[model samples]
Target: MSKIESIFKSCLEPKEVYKGGKNIPASNKKLYKLSSNENPLGASPKAVAAIKKAAENIDLYPDQTDIRLREALVQDFDGQLAADQFICGNSGSELIDMLLRAFINENDEVIYSNPCFLPYSVFSRWYGAKLIDIPLTNPNYHLDTEGILNAITDKTKIIFLTSPNNPTGTYIPRSVLDDFLSRIPKNVIVVFDEVYRHFADAEDYITALPYVKAGHNIIAINSFSKTYGLAGQRIGYCYTTSTIANYIRQIHKPFLLPITSIEAAIGALNDKGFVEETVKTVKEGRAYLSSEFDKLGITYWPTQGNFFIVDPPLPEIEFANKLMEQGIMVRPVSQFGAPGKVRITVGNQEANHALIQALEKIKPD
Candidate 1:
């Protein structure tokens, strides 16, 4: 047998995987990239300075335990959680994978929303878990809590909840989440991916931290990649009760988070002004994009995240290609099970204006 066939016969083809964005080649001219929902403001000055200062220590391995960063996060969360409650990872995606491996057994069922983050399904399948996908509600793209609850079975081991869900930008309301949690069996672990929590504007939307604090089987995941503009730094963390947190840490490889990333995150945490400024920019950009969509007669869901999903009149793939020709990049949601929808990252004022201008030229009257 060929080497590939002998090593892993059950593996699927690479083409079957849904990659996030098209890679744009570097050119002499700068490109305004809005394909990924990254912080347009870039890293905080404090974080940048910290990273530079930490460069001299590159010869040494990162603090194997990442205690200082964990302490900083504890302080940042305002003592809502203890230091032992957190586990740092290379990125939010890595933390997601760790949580899956740590909690899920082979062939166990994993439940999540359709048109949610694509990785949840991919990672669950990687661990040989049966995937249960629930479709979002019509028009609003909100989670179907009742449907999700009904899909649960004794075999179910995990439920992935993404507030301000990817591509859809819809959040689970507090009442809906509470009801869902109450209905779920205690044996199953619920992961609340709050990577975009900083952008949420609604008062009634809840973070899963409270559930974790109450000693529920819930883990709250957050990333510096979005709000803190530390996407390139590759640092994210999870917060849960000490019991589950310790279990996750046991499986996590030591020193996964680099010393530089840890220091940068610490500095970023201290720069509250920068975080507030990023929120303001994203909020303003979201509002502007929404108003423009209204004027263009395009359907879109109001979002509390750094991005919004738009139902362009054309097929999403074709729309995205057309936008690309105009030097604009947007996320096509076909892979996430919403083929007609396009998820546009809210950019700075200039990038937003460019996107609107390009849309005006191609959008059907």
Candidate 2:
């Protein structure tokens, strides 16, 4: 190891990075990119217009005092929570990092479901937190409530609950989450990553934002990347108690969101028609793909989000590579710790049709 390497913690000297859904080396225009759960309809037209309008103001610094983005979110939520309770970050992913920075100390226990958003593990390691990753229950892959309740200790600080979980795409039912929340000690703050809330159509689903208002130690994070199709804009925010929100704001630097990103997200909130259409498209595409997979005798878990896990004809890595070669891109979830599974984002009709066609060609006789 070189002198620079010598200064790093030896056990974690070479950090494993989080990989996003991306195309292959030669994949730009050729591949149907369905790996990232982005809105296939693209960013809301209203958001695009807002971004164009905001681009002229790039010379000035972003607002730190009166954030129109957070102000706008009040109307978006139908006045469920006050503007003071919401805080914005560059993306929902960044809020996790901010949470860790504000609350975590050395050896503080950070607990989350195993095979969750990859960053939960990565950020915990970076913050020197004692990781307590509990495995999800078998079959449906929902949160293992008892396992997590058992794992808690006095050192436990944060619990990450990713509803419509990444890779598995399962969620915590309302009753199950209520019971779990009631049982958890008040000192431990539970973070709900509900970025994909728009796509979850399950009857039992409920957003945990109300719990924050009710004085529960909970935080709910939302993103504009999925249903709003503002992934390129990279804007997200969280709902927490005004007290916790204040602390996060203090820890976070000034002008966290770019002017264009803020304007785009604000516009996205007003684009109700666009959001409804995106959700409609994803629901249709999801049903279409599921029915096709059934006909091909492929095994996959039912998903509430815009993506689901698919077991292909070959091992996951090889299967993912094969799809890439055939002008498609899907994520292999080995990094998310499920070895045999591949994740496919529900795409537009054209893209979804192409994926099924590709799978048909590769299906074992």
Candidate 3:
């Protein structure tokens, strides 16, 4: 066996995958899938058209530079940022891996919130960094910023902060973020994963871009997957100072993004109407879900993202299994460090209705 294989021996294992509403097996009737937080309204017509047009160009390699897509992003953001500030990847996961490789050195410390996105810790471990986790406060599931700052030492190289955090929809308030940044050592690189930024409602919510502009050692990672309904296309980008962006590009594999994905992303960026429609639909569905949960007497977090976390009356794994038996597939939070809680994605009105109906049946009266 190779050294790499030996290193990964214990980590290599297949896990069960669940899709919220994909448990119906294969009946002719369509299943309402609320499992993954995919946009149920589907991709924008403009993006579809762009993909179709780009299909003719499959014979050629994509522009390694991805200039047109970067330009569109620059224009969409009103020229506040330049193309040089962006680095496109196959998905947000790939971007995460790239950042880990670019910044982390052997045994360097990487700090992130527990019950957060598992990939941040996974990548940190893969790159030989010490993964430091700060658990959230109970009940509210808010980040422990002071604990995070106190955990930092000279070996700390990267800190991952996710707003509207995964598994739990709670977000770090802007004031909290400002205070945390002020206390952390300047040498540590911070990654603000704002993949769910569009769903936030707090008036004080702000992207870390301003901090980057102010010359802080930070990177803002965003994805078209959640809001743009392009998760299948696997497109995401990171914005940072030109210096860090150049470093990431140097370490990134050339031509990793295909032509079709680039065109699709560009098309999605231009489809402001579709983006607005998605946001509206999600907001409405989220409100509807909240109301339904309230009426059902089930407890859930107040979400600012496409998904919400609920502490069901039953054990989370058992509750999820029961829902799956009824052809509903919600994600259990055990791996995300919150046992007895399940994370559910908000879908279209019909899908949300289906989920509510399923819960009503399985939940205690």
Off by over 4 Å in 2: 1-12, 24-29
* Model 3 error, position 110 (Å): 0.4
Estimate, for each residue in 224-331, the C-alpha lDDT of model 1 and write its tens digit.
999999998999998999998988888877777788998999999999999999999999998898999899898888898999888888988899888887888888
For model 3, how does the per-residue alpha-carbon lDDT over 169-269 read when each residue is reduced to its tens digit?
88888899888888888889999999988888888888887887877889998898888888889999988888888878888776888888999999899
Per-model lDDT: 0.87, 0.87, 0.84
**Model 1 misplaced stretches (Cα beyond 4 Å):** 1-4, 7-15
Q: What TM-score does each of the candidates earn?
A: 0.96, 0.96, 0.93
Q: Which stretches of candidate 3 lie over 4 Å from their true place?
A: 1-25
- Clash totals for all candidate models: 0, 0, 2
lDDT of 1: 0.87
Which residue pairs collide in model 2, if any?
A: none
CA-only RMSD, every prediction: 1.6, 1.7, 2.7
List, residue by residue over 59-132, the lDDT tens digit for candidate 2: 99977643688889999988988999998898888988889888888889999886778988887778788889
